[model samples]
Target: LMDVARLNGPPEAWHLGFMLGPRINAGGRIGRADLGVRLLLESDVSEAARIAAELDRLNSERRIIEQHAEAQAEAEALASLGLEDKGAVIVTASEGWHPGVVGLVASRLKEKFARPAFAIALEPGGIGTGSGRSIPGVDLGKAVRHAVEQGLLIKGGGHAMAAGVTLRKERLAEFRAYLESALAADVAEARHVNEILIDGAISARAATPELVATLNRAGPFGSGNPEPIVALPSHQLVDADEVGQAHLKLRFKSGDGATVNAIAFRSVGQKLGNALVQHRGQVLHVAGTLTVDRYQGVERVQLRVLDVAVPDHGPAMIR
Candidate 1:
């Protein structure tokens, strides 16, 4: 899997870290414990190819599972927020969810709502295995251990950013309540101080292939280090359409008359998609990371949109 023939340039760290990384992780995530390492070790060309293909299939299945769980978790999170004005953490559990993918789902929910989230998978015997992802400054691990000490969780431990828990299904509600009370102050502080950092403001014309290449040097972005978010200020939405099931493809134009392309993945049915589709010909500030998109031997800079706001609305903040 060292081939970069189809890639625009030599593979950057992200290609190996994200694209291939998930395939390797699928083994652990999906219960095929040895599949990932086996793929890396198989020397026979045909055998390695087969393993790679199977891993790819598993990764795709993982995405589908994560997507479904995320949808359910997001819905629950939003509904819970409606009931409590200061909802700090979203704890969702259900029977039959693949326990392996719950952590991924929690990550997606945390990203969407800017809150600490936990997804629990319940087994037949009233036992649950849960994974959680937390926002900065919230000690998810400490809280989990505290829950164990308080007898709210059967067994649990983790760090500030992530955690794992095993508890009786009956204790789920108690654990949730414990976390809400334990993390209330920290979550509130995190939300109030959380701000999207913009690295720079550039015209659509300035978001070029060269710029994308330069940014890749600083990446392989994940957890603590993230890809930079830049603003395309005052760009008017020109063409907007949904592509690949739920990704919203967009074209924006600056006053100087240059056009740039963007896509908000899995956004077709969300607020961002609805706003963009309705914003034809309207000027807005868009923020996201830039990537070099290669298709059919063509390479171009495209923005993976994260957030957008009216020109007068100021920088996007999550609060």
Candidate 2:
């Protein structure tokens, strides 16, 4: 797998999560549940390679399935909330949606809508299995448990960030209502102060693989300890192209002729992606974490874009 990805150095946390983890999790998502474990336990290098290849294929298939489900769910959410998007929580369901990918759909909805979101797969028997993802400050698991206790769900439980539930198809409306009412204030507060806390500002010329590696020494950033978000203020968007399902691949150039590659994953058709495409060739303030990208034995710094904005006056300052 490393050879296929052209990874010649030690794998970083991003690679583990974005590259290898998804492939391993894909087996459980849409293929044999034990496939990942088998590959890990296999002592023979050739056999492990075969399993890894299969896992990679499964991950590709999962992405296709997830993309379709996400599109449908996003449409449903839009219809529910209208142009105002006034809802605090988003809930969407469809009869043919794959159960395995519903969680992924939920996650996409959460990110795009900036709200807790659920995607349910309705079975022919009138039972719906669903997954949900939540924004910070919303205790989704607690809300789901409350719903279960109130007889809105057949079964449900999860942590704060993600959860799963099963309910009668007839109860989806009640479930949605319960979550909205239960979480509205928390969601409102979270959104009211939803600010990207950038660590610092830098130019495209200053962002380098060594700098990213040094920043990474903060060690294994995640939920509580987030990776630093650095801003590229007043950078011209030289290129923006859709790539690999819904991701936006981009190039940004600083005033000094330095350029950096960036990608906004799963942003297509969302506000961010739309803004980027519409404003191509214009200067914008971009904020995201820097990472070292290895391709074909070459190392380069790439930004995993998180947010962007247009300057009100001249080039926007990070402060």
Tens digits of per-residue lDDT for model 1, 9-122? 333622554478678888789889799999889999999999999999999998888888777877778888885555889999888789999988887778677789999999
Please report, in order, the local distance difference test score of every candidate based on alpha carbons: 0.82, 0.85
User: What shift in Å separates residue 26 of candidate 2 from its native position after superposition?
Assistant: 5.1
- Which candidate gets the maximum lDDT versus the true structure? 2
TM-scores, in order shown? 0.71, 0.77
The runs of at least 3 residues in candidate 2 whose Cα sits more than 4 Å from the true structure, single-residue gaps closed, are 1-27, 34-68, 148-151, 295-298, 313-319
Lowest lDDT 10-mer window, candidate 1?
Answer: 1-10
Candidate 1 residues lying further than 4 Å off, grouped into runs, are: 1-84, 111-113, 136-142, 145-161, 296-298, 314-319
Q: With candidate 2 superimposed using the best TM-score fit, by how many Å does residue 178's alpha carbon deviate from the native? A: 1.7
- Model 1: which residue pairs collide? 141-158
